[model samples]
Target chain A: MTELTEIKKQDLLYQGKAKEMYTTNDPDILWVHYMDQVTALNGKKKVQMKDKGKTNCAISARLFTELREQGIVSHFIEQLSPTDQLVQKVQIIPLETVVRNYASGSFVKRYQTEYLQKFDQPVIEFFYKSDELDDPFLNDDDALALGAATREQMAQIRQLALKANQHLRQIFAKMNVLLVDFKLEFGLTAAGDVILADELSPDNCRLVDLDTKQSLDKDVFRKGLGEMVPVYEEILQRLLKEGER
Target chain B: MTELTEIKKQDLLYQGKAKEMYTTNDPDILWVHYMDQVTALNGKKKVQMKDKGKTNCAISARLFTELREQGIVSHFIEQLSPTDQLVQKVQIIPLETVVRNYASGSFVKRYQTEYLQKFDQPVIEFFYKSDELDDPFLNDDDALALGAATREQMAQIRQLALKANQHLRQIFAKMNVLLVDFKLEFGLTAAGDVILADELSPDNCRLVDLDTKQSLDKDVFRKGLGEMVPVYEEILQRLLKEGER
Candidate 1:
């Protein structure tokens, strides 16, 4: 492993909807810049919201650090700037893992289930991470058939996701927020071990205020409830305030 | 457990797209008459073909008998006539279990994968069997949340489904037919045991001629290849000839 005190960012590798990845001098690391972008409906609806990137970056770093303290491994290395970070580079497994504690979003749309209905167990779903296919929802068998992830890798992801959910639910509950559901992505290490990857923030989480029941996450933007960034900043402030305690 | 020599068919219980169920004098038996009808695209396309009913009933009876001989329990009791049968009455679990050996039909439509692409292992999927909802695809967690089936029952269904696949594949292979994919419906017996139910014929399976690669099952109707009943009769003849051998 290169232990250079100063890592130089190199050519742009990939530009995603919300983040841009740049190669670093270190082969095992990449520099990520979170763009001030928000998208829904597979990038059909997009917006550039000021301070969105910085808010997400801070929340992601804080959550990753908290998870690391609780013995959950992630790709997060360190925050470089308000909108930038350095992370371990790995081949991302193309599966969008969603863990839902309460019925909402497509869960309600698909089965006509009652919104916010509590489930006995957290419902975990896998969606093929393909924009071309509109990110169709699939299952473990479909994921395996698509060669997205091995059976063992999926099992490992489920375990990690459940653990992260438990920790995250507690973290948000302490902030007087209801963690309804969240999405996570995983990558395979060079050693072929599965670890959590991707940014964690209100951007990918469905959160509701414990008392007011107002959506505190991306749904505010998705449903056109109000300005989304203010709600995000509110979550970050609570997180930082809880840190002081 | 009623052993009536003559089970009198009473009144119509349910009318499906391709069959009608009548309550029998015996509480544990259902009189089913396969109708001379075929539906595609979830009943938006409908047609009535001569000999379709008798052909499906015969094929379903033969296949169920073969499965029973292999120690696989199903609800089929006996064939009453060319188009009617007495089935052990079971509460149909509202799940359409699909097992795929090769990609075709909706699998191709969803993933845009090549048709007839073979899979390393059979991919099993579940859909909530609601006509009103258009039978949306779901997972084990979704099923559990909806109270569709228990973890143990799903495991059991998977096991039994795989076993049935093994036998059915060989039977089809011997007939010089390729077993592509099929849908199976399971039901719960009064004692709470899950067992295979529903008709098994060209109506619910995707089969192709081994040499010609022409679809011999419902795809003939779904894709509008030609008259479908003759192709179904071809399958019936092949199955019967294999039995004679």
Candidate 2:
């Protein structure tokens, strides 16, 4: 077991799967250790998905760079190493924000209607906490009833999610891939300014080849399609090769 | 094809499959036609799960009655008929809010983690519009970036979501059913007050027999476990039977 000692030496705060988060003396600065360990199924089933940590760090760093180039603010300051990231430590808002541009996953399972036929309009959803219960889809009333967010804040979140989705979609389109969907996190400063938090990596998104429909994200493991890590590496190699050109 | 026809004498708004919403000229009250059209997978794959809509209505009515009895504020005014609901018309919010108490669905898929472990803390999530992209989980920054909510409002939503979860969990525990997870929605009144909105039906929740592990919600369809509607009916019957005792 990778104890918290190594992280504590650097003033660790929280230890989440794949990353040991540390708070620097400066409240705004954070150091995250992209550990070698990999977790699946919410840490219930831990498998040493070899090199996953390094791969995620590299991919995330690259994606963050791309996002920044496109004017999307993210926490990624720089790649400290293949397995570390230096970031801004904002107070993370406890919400997993998602935006979608295509039809897939629970949406397919929920409505099972034709509404998903290349829906030009984006839709938003909110899920309250209790990961052990698994995150369930919620509506606005439920949100208010549960006090997960206020009506006004939810409106703001929706706009932000939509903007992020649009920006990422444009970037991926240029790369000949469709940014199907992605997860984002946000944090607040003590002063109450919300900033984009969390890592933007292949692990948190779904990327499909425009021509062949090949996935370049962690959906392979999720769907049990097989050999996902290699597929991810291949996608990175392809991106690198294209960059060289 | 359910087409909307205005009964010239009566004003009505044919809202989606689940409800036919209408209002009296007075505008203080609202009538909803709780239809029997139970759609799964957005109506792409239809299963004639008989008595599903009625069961959901009954289940929702019964659950709301219990919630009211417990002094939980909810939108349910009264059950007009087996398939219709009478409610107070308020400004509706177009967001789906979800809260989970146990692990299930995409959480299992995305995290590829355990099914039903208790979390040290509840984890709230948000998704932007469009289920076709399958409700993508989101964070606060994404929420704000999309402009769906404000900073203070998001905080309030979190508190509300947590409170609702606690209330529901307590109620279900007394009923000897585990409130595994459920969806909720909220709306604001003309006076800028947030109130619980929507029907709390079996369709929107996952309930299981405390002893037998028989599912009481719509997870059957999502998981393709088979005969989901009947399973829902069975659960209702069980609840009814318990009430008789």
Candidate 3:
């Protein structure tokens, strides 16, 4: 691995619930530091798990690289450290794009249905990201009325999300994990091209063991079921083993 | 209104929260009996207003006539009585189509915004009409995933909803009333045609005075502002005058 002795991390650009951003020496890149901290219910619940950041970084790096190989573009540049990465700096859109391959989480609650209702196709939802208002779910009209995204951008976002769902679900299926649902965020580069920009790991995805239906993602912590570090580590190990093949 | 001396109301087919349905002697027609009961928040808040049935029937008949004149087909046949109407019976779709010309009521609560946010274009939303589950908002994907409506049917529903919004907004504007938003329902005929059903009145619409911004619809009862009879009467009077012209 190359040492990051030349690049410097300057002023803190922003701090999120589970990550920190810093200005970097390269004008086109930003330093992303994944934190061990995790939050749920819009920060009502919080916890710190050892090695969480390292595990997530590893998974995100591998997935983003794999997605690129699959013809889906992202903002990932390269991993600088175990918990830090240098990514192409883009203006993050104020939306959380969600894709549900199966009925779970808020989908079940909203529809008042039983768990894991398999959908014939993936359902894409866009939520306006405002923690103050608990991130209200939005449709295309709501998005346009609020000036969150244009019609063309929304169409692109939906297409990209469905593509990612197909690729990621297959990848997890190979490891005997069911990629139930996940949230995504997109950003616009300086040239106004929308590309995937957020981390893709257990923190943002719901993964269930195919045989046991046990939660292997953040749902464990969110539901107060068990330790998240071991499950996250398990995910990382699975991905790494696949990479070796 | 035509007298119903020859027609006979047969078996009670169904009873909704605000209306009752009865089979008619014509076999192809159904008798819609509007009730005075007004419900909101999924029937959690309700009250019986005197003359509500008669007023709503008059308003719905006039509006339906106006919409038909504007080239929108519906099931409305003719007014049989002040509180009853003859309509074509069809299998009702389990979805409520909503068109919003301005942000109000649940829209404001969903987005956490103040009321009366005018839209340059009307927004259309679909809700699965289930009283047990409070009729959750749905998109085209959700509707298809739940087997609620086919893609072709949803496309038609959306187009018809937008068309209805355009026609209704213009009609209300002519009466010095701002048609904020309204709900609609569509049903398939025995011959498999989707036509508009359900009453359009103060209960199902949010109408504001163009000059005073006064609550002229069910918000009068829902928000405990004042009596609703006078405002409904005002609406019916205005429409009747427009009809005479």
Candidate 4:
């Protein structure tokens, strides 16, 4: 498990790959220490994949900034350093929320049809919070039956996801990239407000070139079909170019 | 797009490329006609194979029967014929509920560390309900945020997913196969009951021979490794042989 040596006198709150999370004894804030590592094929294969952490951190910071500019609530308080982030730690939600603008990957596998030729309305899916299960999809009734959320809260989350989707679509379109789809996580504040939490990086998002279908995110690694860091760097350059414009 | 004529419906449904879905005029019954067309990815390219539907339907029916015998609630009502299934009509849950007994897929991609290696615990994930979007993962909070599920519903769905995991593990273990992971869907009745729904076929599962690690499910297509139908058929023969004991 990755350890947070920078934060003092706090018990390790939780540890996940790529980051070590800790509480500051204040109970209101959480500190995440990002590490430089990369994995693929369900950990059956691993490589140092140098500078991945920094690249992901920079990408996440840029995205969070863009998302905040668009009025979406996010946990990113500040970039403590290139390798760390200070965030308003809310009750981290367990689900992996996704919003999609185009078709690809498992969608093609599941339908086994040519539906990907046309863009469909953005859709939302819920998976139970278990990684060993490889993040299966869940339906509204299934979520309700699980008792993890109330009807009102589920409604609020959906609205926020859609709003986030709209904002992301607009932002990516401006960059001449398709937002194809992306995963999101959320948490509850002490006051019970659901806010977006988690890193919004190239790793969790699938950004494709509008014309070439060139992928600019971590799907490159999972599919084992393309180079990783260069693609990340290329996307960063694109974002920077867009910013300059 | 594959259609079934009345005369060929039985064999075609049992052995077709896609299932034919029909809604009863009464609105209380749903009909699913299975087909015979099969496709597989033997290595890097997808190939249209033959007689996959029959192999999958037989295997799915057998597994559903085994699950039901073990007191697991599933969408399978009964095998109507060699090619069709008679199931209680319910609102098909749009989520593909997956439970994994082993580490695999995107779980490794996200964490990028070995501490989470092949978790002994099952992990659940929710993917959004859009083939056009590539079935991207969504977290519980995101699912709630998207109005796809309530907190309470998610909890229930998680419990059900875990239970199903246990059931599948037990059955597969007895047959000397590792139930690596499987996808599931749930549905809601008009009376607000959540029940397991969707086809439990080789297409939706990854079965590995306990000794050989030879795949017995649809991953043969995803990986593009060839001779998938034969692999499925081999698993069926094995399961049948095991049942005789």
DockQ of all models, two decimals each: 0.89, 0.05, 0.71, 0.04
lDDT tens readout by residue for model 3, B1-245: 23446678999999888899999777778899999899988999888888999999999998899889988889999998899999988888888988988999878888877699898778888899888879998888888888888888888888888888888888889899999999999998888888899899998999999999998999998888987898999999998887787
User: Per-residue lDDT for B117-168 in model 4, tens only?
Assistant: 3544566777766555556566554455345666676677788778877877
Better of 2 and 4 by lDDT: 4
Model 2 regions lying over 4 Å from their true place? A1-9, A37-40, A113-116, A144-147, A150-152, A241-245, B1-245
Query: Which candidate leads in DockQ?
Result: 1
On DockQ, the stronger of 2 and 4 is: 2
What is the lDDT ranking, best to worst?
A: 1, 3, 4, 2
lDDT of 1 by residue, B1-245 (tens): 56756799999999999999999889889999999999998999999999999999999999999999999999999988899999989998888999999999888889999999999999999999999889999999999999998999899999999999999999999999999999999999999999999999999999999999999999899989999999999999999999998
Q: Candidate 4 at residue A26, lDDT?
A: 53
lDDT of 1 by residue, A2-111 (tens): 76458889999999999999999999999999999999888999999999999999999999999999999999999888999999998999999999999999999999
Comparing candidate 1 with candidate 4, which one achieves the higher DockQ?
A: 1
Q: What is the DockQ of candidate 4?
A: 0.04
Please estimate how well model 1 matches the true structure, expressed as its whole-model Cα lDDT: 0.94
Off by over 4 Å in 3: A1-6, B1-6
> Judged by lDDT relative to the true structure, which candidate is superior, 2 or 3?
3
Model 2 achieves a DockQ score of 0.05
Ranking by TM-score: 1, 3, 4, 2
What TM-score does each of the candidates earn? 0.98, 0.52, 0.97, 0.52
